[model samples]
Target: MRISTSQFYETSSANYQRNFSNVVKTGQQASDNIRVRTAADDPVGAARLLQLQQQSNLIDQYDGNITNVRNSLGTSESTLNGITNILARVKELTISAGSGGYTDADRKADAQELTQLEEQLYSLMNSRDENGKYLFSGSRGDTPPYVRNADGTYTYQGDQSTLSLQVGDMLTMASNESGYSVFEQALNTSRSQTKLTSPLVDDGRVSLSNGQVSGSTQYNDRFRGGEPYTITFTSSTQFKITDAANNDVTLEATGEGKFDPSKPGGVTFRGVEMALDINLSDADKPNADALIAGHTFSLGSKPDEVSGSRSPGNTSSSQITGASISDSTAYNNAFPGGGAVIKFTSASAYEVYAQPMGPDARPVATGTLTGTPATKAKIAGVDFDFSAPPAAGDQFSVKVDNHQTQNILDTISEFRKALELPVDKDLASRQKYQGALQSAIGNLESGANKVAEAISSIGARGAALDVQADTNESLKMANTKTQSSIRDADPAEVLTRLSLQQTMLQASQLAFTKISSLSLFNRL
Candidate 1:
């Protein structure tokens, strides 16, 4: 076939252009460290590279988020640790206060120190993050979690829900615990009580153990609570009881132990049970008989306001000796109104009288309470066993209740109260202080456990974040390597390809020149 020189030159020129373009592309790939500069270079590889880049960017973003989680979790762990330490210190202080050796002044000083500890605990509970967000406020990050009430009580103002952060594609972790759970709920120490008081034990022959409400299921079912009973022994063998409504209780020896102030026996009259100590000394006989007088002992549904000599119900053994459903429910029913106050008019009597109730409240049920070594006065469900010589005018009281604060606050308050109490405090006062202090100590251990649990969860969340971060790092490294293999050209391979392409281009140009010059003239 006869080929024209022009056609040959055209073909050779096209070859040279192709070679030159290949060399330029290889050199660019080597210099730029990329294999596909545009989609046209490698369509499939370009799409894959795009996907890998997105994955890499996502991994990097997660790493950043994980770093933030770590910071928050670390801060939470440290803060909880601080709280636990405060609890430990408070526990130690409580033990010292209950020793019963120190005077009221020593306890007051300890209470002052406890006040500082409470402040520290409050500060920790209300701690904020570096960004000024309350750590324990749950999702309500902008608001403070705890607020001090007007009554000097601390209240939780934050929601109970926790905050969480996304740590992985399908994983989310709780970043914080609610303030209510960590502080308020866990440390709740408020309780219901039916405390009692004992008469003066100045007469050694008449030693009185603190009195308590054993139980009167019938009394609980028949009468409203918070009512005090007035037991007036008409004689050594007989007595009469009255209620807040002035209802009369007939004292018939229905139980084995009868209400005989002259001997030991149990008397059950109108669902109330009391043990009578007939073993009274000669001095106690008149005093025990004097219990026949009206308003000998008063029982308030509320706790007593017993302060140093300046308080009500502070004379003689005017202290809570026993606590039960203080013979009535008329007390708990008196909410939003003044608390019930049950005071004893005389130390010689085991009878309690209901104080005047609000106009709106129902009259409290009153019944006779006689105590004996054989059958003790049952308050609530517990029994009271004691032997004491009574003197007329020896008084005691039973107050309803107070909402004591959490472990730290209630404990500190009780300790302070004990310390400030006079050494001449009635036997009931001493027992009450000791019981409250001991209860506070028990509550502290549980509070510490809650703090520890919170710290543990924080640790677990931190570990999870660390694992997610590590996984992301691994994926990032793999993504980079795969991305390089798909999009980048090796320098050595690129250089070699560029050299071959240049050589081919030069050879094509030389051939084109030779062919163009040959023609029919050179052949002739």
Candidate 2:
């Protein structure tokens, strides 16, 4: 092939320039210690490296999530520990109170200490996390979980929602406990003196103008002919009376010495009903009377006759003849059995009978009694009546339900007040309360243990995640190395190739210079 001298020189000069550029670029790349600076240099290596970098970033994110979960669990654990400690102290106080040697003053001091402990428990229940969120409030982390009432009751303000965190793929852990279960359920089932006894009359009777017993009086007859009458209830609620025909008669206050049958009354069976004729002139000591009215017996079917005389002057002048029965007959008719038996179906429930007495007259025989076909006794403003016979040697159980921890503490305080027996008797009573308190403490401890175990489980999972993250990071690094080997330029090899290119460029430049100098002569 015939080639021109000018063309040969031009091609050689271009080759020289290309070789020189290659030498410089390769040398610079080798100095930088990276084989591929851009995608264009090594497309496959660049894509693989980017994938590895993304994996590394994901590992970092996983690590951060694990950190957050650990922090949350730690805070929760601390708060739960505090609650456990308080419960332990309460258990100790309960044991001390049950020793039977402490005086009322001692009990009062213990109660005060318990009150403070309850307050501490309240504070613990409302503990916040590092992020200013309530730990025990469950998913409602923003609000306080426990609310204290004026009557020393506690109300659970938080919902039963649990907060969950994802620690791994398809693995989640609960980060919080429900305040409702921990506080509300705990408070409801864990104390003594939980129940109060209110006076109730079954088969109640009133005077009638007619011969047969009739409810045609101005005052409403709550009971039917055959159904038992419920005169009072011990709860903070009103009594419900179901007639033989299943009718409800509601009663409320009307005026002085009167009751409205359709309204709600404020008198609870266990609660004292005090009527105060408040004189604005005397602020220190107000005139107070027992708001509760005595049971009145009469001879007519009219309830208004209940407020009238018990018997007429003469049998001929009487509306109902032979209505004036003896107190023994009345007591027998009301109780059926002689009024000395007490029946109990459970610890807090019992039934007994109250002997007939004149208005405002205390019963001659008023003491604790228990047997079949229950008896009634008046003690400490409570009329304990037993419906069924209790187990041999069984006593009436008192249970108190309160809203707040402090309210439960106050209920204990009331129990201490109600127990006015000798030290041994009081000790026995205190033991009953102590047993209940111990049960409550056990429940709390069990809950706390469960929470702690759960937290530990979460911590283990978090630790596992940390290991996984580390492994993933290592995998990413190895993957990056593989990608570099496959497509990235090796520094040493690149530098050597660059040096060869530079040498080739130098030789091409010298040859081109000689060619340019003798083009015409060489062509000839």
Number of the predicted model whose TM-score against the real structure is largest: 1
Residue 375 displacement (Å), model 2: 40
Judge candidate 1 at residue 260 and give its lDDT: 42
Q: Specify the highest-lDDT model's number.
A: 1
RMSD of 1: 16.4
Q: For candidate 2, write residues 427-519 as lDDT tens digits.
A: 334444443444444444444545455446656755766675666567667866776676556767887788788789878878877766874
Candidate 2 whole-model C-alpha lDDT, 0 to 1: 0.46
Off by over 4 Å in 2: 1-14, 162-488, 521-524
- Please give me the total number of clashing residue pairs in predicted model 2: 31
Taken over the whole model, the C-alpha lDDT of each candidate is: 0.58, 0.46
Give the per-residue lDDT digits (tens) of candidate 1, residues 280-352: 5566667664543222333322342211111232444333333444434533453212223232234433433
Q: Please give each candidate's TM-score.
A: 0.59, 0.51
Error of 1 at 501 (Å): 1.8
Reference-based TM-score, model 1: 0.59
